[model samples]
Target: MSKRVLLPEDPRWMPFCKRYAGNIERFAIEVVGITPSYQQMELFGSVSPSRSRTSVASGHGTGKTAGIAVIVLWHQLCYPMSVTLLTANDMDQLKATVWKEIGISHERIRRGRHGWIAEHLEILADASCRIKGFEAIWFTESKTANEKTANKMAGRHGEWLLVIADEASTLPDAVLTTLSGALTEQHNRMLLTSQFTRNAGFFYRTQNELSIENGGEWNNLRFSSFDSPFVSDSSLKELWDQYDDDERNVRLLGISPQDSSKHMMNRKVAEAMYRRGRIIKDNENYGWLVLVDIASGEGLRDKSACILARVIGYGDMGPDARRVEMVKVPLLTNKIRSNTFAGYVSDNGAELSNVTYVIDSGGLGINVCQDLEDMNKVVHRVNWGNPCFKNINKDRYLNLRAQAMHQAARAAKDGRLSILTGDYRNQMLDQSARIPKTFTDKGRIRVPPKGATEWDGMGSPDLWDAVCFAFLEDVSYIVSGEIGMGGLVNSAADTALKRTEEMFSDV
Candidate 1:
């Protein structure tokens, strides 16, 4: 058997050398696959690259981590004696995953004296690269670490440094601020990667602000799993097929999906009923309503919004009532403006008489209720206290809402929920599944991924707000002897009243 002896110029040596090129070259060859396309090469080679920052927005399995690894090696080798920092949302993650990959790649490169890789054609003698966990790097709790690290990294005068942030979306704004600060007083490069989301976090804001100015300091690169040469076409198709509409949009399409848990009414159910012309009832009194959730002011961490609706109500249905419907005005920001919100309430059925406005007085909803009261509208502040008590039988309310959502999901699965087949309902359904369940300290439920706090997406707690208000209205009428109860009245009324009150209470 003849063994193939590889020479310096041989393609076999190419991978080793390419894997260790300076930050830009390594990314082009190892990660991106083709030599930096003309634009990429020139962009990186420029003395002062207009965009010192670049974001590779790609789908899962697109070798994002691998691409990042190559960039780290490149930075270390390209600028001898320079410092490059690699960090993520969590430090353990940096060491466990990213650093492990870098270590393996670095080891493969034939070592030369003074920390240089001869086979990879890169040198890292005087340069020191450190992988710091985001917690230690950002100082989320203690300012001491963050300030010290920021000052040390930033004060490195006459040194070239590059900072690479992985999973940029998950990092808090404070950490990002610290990282950004490290670039001050020196020539530095920034590379960020994440799936796109609607919240204007530091990453989103930086990308947008820099892009708009055309300031030549930032570049936004977006890619889907299909764009990856490493991902097989067949596998990509299978992934798309397996993911539900929401997951497909968020994970593969780079669009942010709404969080599912926050929704009270399922889009699927709404669509199904709408298709059968059952959305709005005939010869029934319909009215406009408003639903609100208060803000916690954790900044991008968590904010809230309410859902206002122009609902066409169906008066009491018979025991065997088969037909019931309501026309729902969709939730929109512009429509929720103070003037618009007040106008909707004051314009009572367009007759200018006092209209019924239901407001959530839980958390931040208290402020909204006050706003409505000041406006002189007959605002019914529905109090939904914290649904966190151990004895509260929280599952009842959760189950009811879950059942409503599940009914919708099943309807969608059964091809029953295609009513008003446009983008709105579809988008809503897509966002809902992304909402992950979070168990709070007080045993209350919330959504993980934290992004659900924003009302920008369809997953805003708006639907839940609307449903709670509706529940309150029903309970109020029933308690006031205005409505008669049916066979399921005991279970429904008890569950509804308990959950509604618990959810709206200030505590």
Candidate 2:
């Protein structure tokens, strides 16, 4: 193998290379001959050796394409044997915007004082950029990001690798994961830029996870079109007049689209909770409950799901201790017989006497609960189709199911609830996201019957049903009261506290 060449060490280029190795902004303005906007400059500053991961969410007219192209050129010119992989949601996007911008920037440098450096660099007909003699070692290449092209992004090892994911929000998770695998070296860097079109994705996670408010420790930049000097005030006014708040959020505010009014749970919130993946531990500050949402029939199409959930207590002082934590507690099988499930409960109940079993009393649930109760287990049977008891959310829900799901959705939105990672994670996320909501004739919040909704042809959302079942307001044992304080409640105090809890639940 031939020895690697270091471009910055050459006496002729040493001063120029040393000046720009740490400052990509100066390199873009002086070397690449382009003026970067304030937002773009901030992005350049944020991409340090220590923090190689930089995510940029920008509105339209922010010149993100130009910013990305300049960075690609900077990496190729300054670093030795560097490989820059440029990718977007589609091949057409590569040809139209960022790839086109790269060609323009390359020409600018080719005609400038640094024209000698651009002489060795070639933008091939195949859309690959490389130094003339060191074609194998130094280059920038474009690949359409998708499941089919994901493999092309992996195993890209080099001394200095820079992966630029343009329009990253539109790329699939598979492509992002593959691209992430390529950045294994310390010198390797990745830049993700996109309009915040959707809320749940790697791009969204980069922004949300690294936020200062979330106690994140990396660089996450947000740039609005209004902040860009190129976007005229008159054009912004036209955008404001043409679109509503949600539309303008994505187009001008550089923010993710807000949760739509239709879906009961936002996919982004659910994904964040899953990413958090905080496991629940048995403690004095929490009361555990077994929540079950059983399949209605004996068909193999539907499965019953059971979750171990907790109501947090006052003793815990941690920042996130106030939220409920849920785990997908196992059953005998996906399609467990009612008798077999009751047996499993009997086996586990001795170890968790303080925990109560709350089972849905619809279809097969009633029979299962009856069996458990006959076996001398205290079971709370909740009829989801029945009207919710009054004083809950000012009678906003049309039925108990709606009330439970609405509360659970609200808890997820408020960051007051978390679902631990498990074997059924993807299923749980899809199910939660597929929850459909409507208003009753009386304008009460209504979650449609499970049969009314379908996601990716999924039959019933067993896991999400268990989650919603866990959030039933009336059934949640108040951990601050006699029930949790001593794990036992005398009849008189129980009656009084139960009434009080009903009157002021979630207040």
Best by TM-score: 2
List model 1 lDDT by residue over 1-507, tens digit each: 975332333454445445444346544454334444333344344322412667655456666665565566655444434456665545655565566656555654434222223233332322223322221221111111243355554443335666777667555666667666666544577776776543456766655665535564556665566666666889778667544455454467654445553332354544454466434332233343444444444444233334433243221122211122223333423324443444443443233122356665665556666767786766776554434222323422233232233333433443332233232444344444433332221112333433454334433444333433443313221111111122322333455687789999987
Give candidate 1's TM-score: 0.45
* RMSD after Cα superposition, model 2: 18.3
RMSD of every candidate to native, in Å, equals 16.4, 18.3
For model 2, how does the per-residue alpha-carbon lDDT over 1-507 read when each residue is reduced to its tens digit? Answer: 975444544465667668887788998888888888898899888774633888887777888778888888888878778898988766775777777898999999988888767766788877788876778878898887789878877778877888888878778888887888767777888888877756677778888975545776446788898999999999888656544354467667888766685677778978877766554443334566777877777467588877767666321123532467774456524657765776776565444435778887787778889988897766888887778776534345678788778767766765667876475777778878878765432225676665664243557777788777766656755342223212443334556777899999979
- Steric overlap count per candidate: 27, 0
Worst 10 residues of 2 by lDDT: 313-322
Estimate every model's Cα lDDT from 0 to 1: 0.45, 0.72
- List where candidate 2 sits over 4 angstroms from the true fold: 1-11, 48-51, 210-217, 261-507
TM-score of 2: 0.51
